[model samples]
Target: MTVLILSVFVLVYLGMAIGRFPGLQIDRTGIALLGAVILALAGAIPGEALATAIDYPTLFILLGLMILSAQFELAGFYGWCAVRLAQAALSPVALLALVVAVGGGLSAVLANDVVVFAMTPLLCAGLVARGLDARPYLIALAGAANAGSAATIIGNPQNILIGQLGHLDFWPFLAACAVPAVLAMVCVFATVAFIWRGRLELADASPLPLSPPDLDLWHLKKALLATLVLLVFFATPLPQEEGVLAVAAAMLISRRFASRRMLGLVDWHLLVLFAALFVVTAALARTGLPAAMVATLANSGWAPDRLSVLAPLSLVASNTIGNVPAVLLLMQVWPSPPEGALYALAVLSTLSGNLLLLGSLANLIVVERAAASGVTLGFWEHAKCGVPMTLSSIALAIGWLWAMGHVGW
Candidate 1:
């Protein structure tokens, strides 16, 4: 049973890292689900224990946020923001800052992937229309989204998982991560705008003029109201999952977007992936091998309870297998991690994705979207900003967290 659980866990995570089997059509989500099924069939995890293994709060919080984002996407609010940012009466450098500002800021509140998806084309089109190169702005878009999403527990999926699993509150988590997030965004803008200074000026006007998506003002208003109410609830003693679920329910009650369509937009695959990971991880934990291994490693100064250990470890792991998987792996092994260590792990894992184009989903979305739209933002072009962005941002995050006396090596 132990070997079977370990084997299933290993194979599933391998699929997660590679994103697919060599010849199989399965994705990370499918691989995770498969692992859980294998465990169940083998009796590694029993009936009642199955439900206990999954983190329902995290899954529901993620679901509600995705639905809220979908409503805004359908209403064209993100498009409206991007177009408005694009037309700002600012110079290239200033405009890039504004672009980063908006991308990063909104990502703290909404799903960065959705924000990037809506903003990319409009941003690229608007900038390209003015004869400025879109590559740098695109890079900044990716980096800023990663950084900004670090500011809050709800910003991205990994942080959401960390927050839910850690039982982190909204305001306190924000206070812990906001400074590093802000500094990272600044670093993102500086690296891109400075490196691509000349190119940010006129290249050639876009051969194709593009218009932003039309805004459904009514739905937009509805989402904004619901969001504000959610925020107020977040400030209160209310649970994030419950508040977000209520908000999502309110949005679904709308006549403009059908419930099925809106729910369809939610990343159910990701929620399933989370649930599957939890089950497989719980099965792994029952083997006692993890706790023993973690105990042995703690003496070697690699325990996740140690901030110095978790930070760099998280940075490397996050980039290696992606942030979500890294967090899940840590969850399986790390027992009763300190709040400081968890916060550090969450923020560092998120911000470190700025290191590579494939590092984060937000970055990937921006790159793929740019490619399909005829702009060629290649590796080097992205790395020019990404490498520096990662280094500077991580440094800033560590420094800020240290200064604020959160935790430091």
Candidate 2:
């Protein structure tokens, strides 16, 4: 049974590594959910064990955040910010800076994937209108969102899981992770600007037709107020899950927008992936391979809590299976991880997402959206910016972690 479970696990994760099953159209989520179903039908996971394996709190928090982001989208707030950023009178370089700044800033508070989705088309269209190539802007947009989301617990799906499972304090996690995130955003801007220096703006570039997003002050104000209330709750003694749920509930019931409209925007597929991965990981753990692996690492003096050991591990894992799934797998072996290490994993895993086009969903989102506007960001084009930004950002995070330790943080 253990061998069978482990075999299924390996095959599923192999699918994850390749982004799909060969000769099959299954996505990562589909692959994962299928693996869970296979194990359950094979009696590899008992009913009682299945219940404990799925992390409900993490899922609830993630679902709530997704709904909250939906409210922002349905209300046109995200599109409004993008249009506003596009209207800035800044030069190409300065505009790139604003893209990184706003993209990263919004990601710190909202779902990073959603942030990229809402902002990419606007940036692409805006850049083309200004006779600028959308490649650099797209890289900056995606990279900044990934980096910035590392600053807060609610910033991304993986961070939310880490925060909930580790019982991390919201304020402290933000404080510890913010410095690295900010510096990473700078790294993103500098790297993109330098690489695409002369080619940043294309003088003869013709603007692509882009329909402007709708904006409503009424819905926007309501969503903003709910976000404010959520932030306040973060600073309170209330459970983060409760605070998020309360805010999400408020956003779901709007006077103008139907509840179905906002709710439909939620990433139900992603939630399915989380749940299915949880079951898969739990089954793997029960086979004792995870414990054995940890024991072997301990014997070799390797520790996930040590930045030196953990950073590279997280980078590879994140890039391979994607960050969210990588973190979920690592969590089982790294029970009660240290505060610094936890912060390191969260940021490093996120920062590593800028390594390649397929490194994170955010990167793919930007690329796909750019292609829709007739702006192609090929694999190498993204890597030209992604590789350097990833290296520099990870280095920055390591330095910050070291400095904080020295200062008794």
Candidate 3:
């Protein structure tokens, strides 16, 4: 049973790293789900234990947040912002700054992946129509989303998991991570601007019609109200999952928007991935391998709580198997980590995702949408800015973490 669980675990994570099974259409989500199912069939994890393995609160919070972000998407809020950014008569660098600012600010409160998904194509079309190279801008936008999403517990999926599992407070997390996030956004702007200096302008650009987004002011107002209410609850003693579900319930009561459409915008694949990975990791945890490994690592002075170990681990694992999966693996292995360590994990894993094009979901969304908009953003092009931006931002994050007494030697 132990060997079977280990084999399944290795295969699932390997599939995660490579993003698919060769000669098959199975993706990461499918792989994780299959692995969990295999373990259950093998009696590695019983049905009752399997049910207990999943963390429903994390899923509920994710669902609520996705609904909130979808309201903005459907109301044309993100599209309107993109149109505004495209029309801004600023210099290339100034526009880059604006892109980072907008992406970062919106992602700080909403889901970063959804923010990029809604804005990427619109922004790309506007830039390409203006005879400007859209690659740098697209890269900067992805970087900004990742960096900005590091600020709050509600910003991104991984942070939400960390906050929920760690039971981290809203304000202390902001205090610990906000500065690093801001600095990372600055790094995004600077790195992209510096790398794309000579290629900011295009001579023979294809012109396309940039249509305005369909605006629904009333629905937009409701989404804003829900967001405001959510923030207020965060400031209170209410459980985050309950607060999120309450707001999501209210969002479903809309007269203008259908609950089906709003729910459709949620990333159901990701939610399934989370549930599946929980089972996979829980099955492995039952084997005692993870706990034993943690004990050995701690005795050898390689505990994840230390900044040096966690920073590099986050960078490598996040870019490899992806940040969300990486976080789940770590949380499973190292249960009940220090509060500061949880903060470090959230911030570092998020910021390190800018190092490669496949680092974060937001980055991939930008790339795909850019391709649809006739703007090709290759891996090397992204890496030119990504490598430096991630390094500098990570350095700043480590420094801030040390200064705040979160992690140190």
Each prediction's whole-model lDDT (CA)? 0.85, 0.86, 0.92
Q: Residues 5-55, candidate 1: write the lDDT tens digits.
A: 889988988887788899889988899999999898889999899989888
Q: Candidates ranked by lDDT, best first?
A: 3, 2, 1
TM-score of each: 0.95, 0.96, 0.98
Q: Using lDDT as the measure, which candidate wins? A: 3
Instruction: Give the clashing residue pairs of candidate 1, or none.
Output: none
lDDT of 3 by residue, 102-211 (tens): 99999999999999999998998788777788888899899999999999999999999998888888999999999999999999998998888888865544444676
RMSD of 2: 2.0
Write model 2 residue lDDT over 180-260, tens digit each, in one string. 999999999999999999886657534434456878878878878888888887767788888888888888776778988
Task: Pick the winner on lDDT between candidates 1 and 3.
Answer: 3
Better of 1 and 2 by TM-score: 2
Q: Candidate order by TM-score, highest to lowest?
A: 3, 2, 1
Instruction: Flag clash pairs in model 3.
Output: none
